[model samples]
Target: MASTDAPPLDANRYRQDFPILSSVLHGDQPLVYLDNAATTQRPRCVIEKIVEVYERQYANVHRGIHWLSDQSTDLFEEAREKTRRFINAPLREEVIFTTGATGAINLVARSWGDANLQAGDEILVTEMEHHSNLVPWHQLAERSGCRVKFIPITDEGRLDLEQLPALLTEKTKLVAFTAVSNVLGTINPVVEIVEQAHQAGALALVDAAQSAPHGRNDVQAWNADFVAFSGHKMLAPSGVGILYGRASLLDAMPPFLGGGSMIHRVTMDGFEPAELPAKFEAGTPPIVSAIGLGAAIDYLEDIGVDNIHHYAQMLTQQAHDVLEEVGGVRFFGPPPAEKAGIVSFTLEGIHAHDVAQILDQYGVAIRAGHHCAMPLHKRLGVAASNRASFYFYNTPEEIDALADGLRAAKRVFRR
Candidate 1:
């Protein structure tokens, strides 16, 4: 039997690292933050890293020979190395910086998809995809004359893996899916999906925006051809994200944007693009946020990713068990064993936004509405749902508070 015991963690100690967690809201009630899936609060270390870069070493990277520029450039490249190590990418140059996961997906769609996909080629995605993952492919298909298809999810909110074999075929050029669903909390079987995609001669691109924070996104283990995730989703600042592509494949693709440092030489007519990562990262990159992301990576490593994953799983199971006992709660996705530390559900008669607003009165914060997964919400037969997502810094007490808040919302709505 699988172990039910959760690994021990000093969540209070971890909570102290995030200064914003100390804030009291809605009168004197302590804040109960359950929205880490949107963006995690930054720790002191990550905040300090951002401040350090701006206060001490801020400069445009890659062009200047002065000391400040040299220092800033070194730190910027070091962050790339940090990201490469964070996701276990095979090579440092394989990690390309972008605006966010949305930008990263667009990069892959425009550069690789445009170059490789033919008129009749098909790109396979999941119905559970966030708009970031789905829209880019749709746009790509519209431009390149390729078809976009979806892998259906079961009633339980898990991908119907039995259909994978039939869905994957010679005409399928790529299979783009999320490693974890932002709405359903479903953790897809990445290794199985990647292997199947490869067997069918299709590349795999994993949208790891949700899973990256929980720390199980190992590109080497999954053998994914491309992966995209946001640093902000993993406790760093916003406006920075990563795209990890196989070095050889990245080298072969055309550049997504043309400008500045991404080029080797600029003629009056055409310019030759730079190599590997720089080829994709055009203009001035998000230097300060990248450095902060590096610090965030360092902070997570110090806590041990495996430990965080276990604690988050425990929290998910605890919340799931408690919410299941609530009278009107209807949960989405598989059980905690197959999901991340996320619980999306609906209360019997209350609207999702109203539930969230009531929870806010109790100082509990959660996400509501389509959560950028309108297709998945449509599949689940609901226009919106309430989502309480957890992280290592979250506590059982907060989950309890969430349950209390839910009951309170129900009582208010029942009146």
Candidate 2:
């Protein structure tokens, strides 16, 4: 069992680091932000770092000898190194900056898939994957004449691990899945999945968008061929994500995009691509956003990932207990203790959209929709559901507020 008594953290002091959390929503109500699974609030350190880069070191990197350009280039490379360490990649050169998780997944589908896959080859994914993880493999399958397969998911929203051995075979080219379900909050056994993929002679890719913020991630331990996660979901700015691939795999895969820095020589016949990460990062790249991500990682490190994980789990459990006491609410995902920081459910006889609107009046902000995991929602026999995702800064008082809002919603809809 994970320890709940994390090193003493000043929640109030840490809350001060996020400016948005201090703001008044709808004129007077304190914001109870439960949409963290969508995007986390950026800390002041991250915001300040992004602002500083544009104000102080705004210049194109990698090709200029001027002071501003040199400084910008250095900062950009430093950010890459920071990301490398944050995910525990073997080499900094393996960290490729992407527009976001979607872009990173697409890069793998286009570059690696196109290079390695052929007709009769199969790319196996899970039924619980977000659309970002699913569509890329589907497109890759269509383009490369490869087939797409799905590992079965249980009624409880957890992957059926017992079914994995049967799903994987010699024809399997890659196995991609989410580390945590965006809607269900099921923490998939990534290490076990990786081992299964390797035993079947398939590459493993993990979509870490939902897991990276909550715990320490070591791709080395999982032995994943590629790992992709967005910065915005981890309290960093939008427009930046990290794609961590094995150095050999990244070196061998063809470039996903063609443009400025991704090329070594552009002849009339063909263009020679740059090496590793540069080959994948085609354009000028997200300079300021990368700096913000580095600062976000720094902020998370200061608080300690273990502390964040423990606090979030406590908050999630509190939410589960409160919601369970409510008469009309029906919880989804693994039982409260087995899941991560996300709680998703539906209210009896209430549309999810209606639930969201009613909750807004109390300033209890919870997300209500398909949450970009439509197939998972469909498999669970629901069109949509409400989701309340917690972070380290969230409190028990906020959970009470959410319960009050849900009660109010039930009363409003009961008529």
On TM-score, the candidate that comes out on top is 1
**Least accurate 10 contiguous residues by lDDT in model 1:** 1-10
Task: Give the C-alpha lDDT of model 1.
Answer: 0.92
Give the per-residue lDDT digits (tens) of candidate 1, residues 191-231.
Answer: 99999999999999999999999856889999999999999
In the range 1-415, model 2's lDDT, one tens digit per residue, is 1334643366778889889998787888899999999999998888888888899997988888899999999998888988898899989888999999998999999989999999999999999899999999888888889999998888887899898999898999899999998888888899999999999999999999999998878999889999999999999899999899999988888888899999989999999998777888888999889978888998999899878887888887888888888878888889766667999999999999999999998888899999998888888899999999989888778899999999998888773
Clashes of 1: 0
Report clash pairs, candidate 1.
none
- Candidate 1 Cα RMSD after full superposition onto the native fold (Å): 1.6
What's the distance in Å from true for residue 220, model 2?
0.4
The residue ranges of model 1 lying beyond 4 angstroms of the native Cα positions read 1-7
How accurate locally, in lDDT, is each candidate? 0.92, 0.89
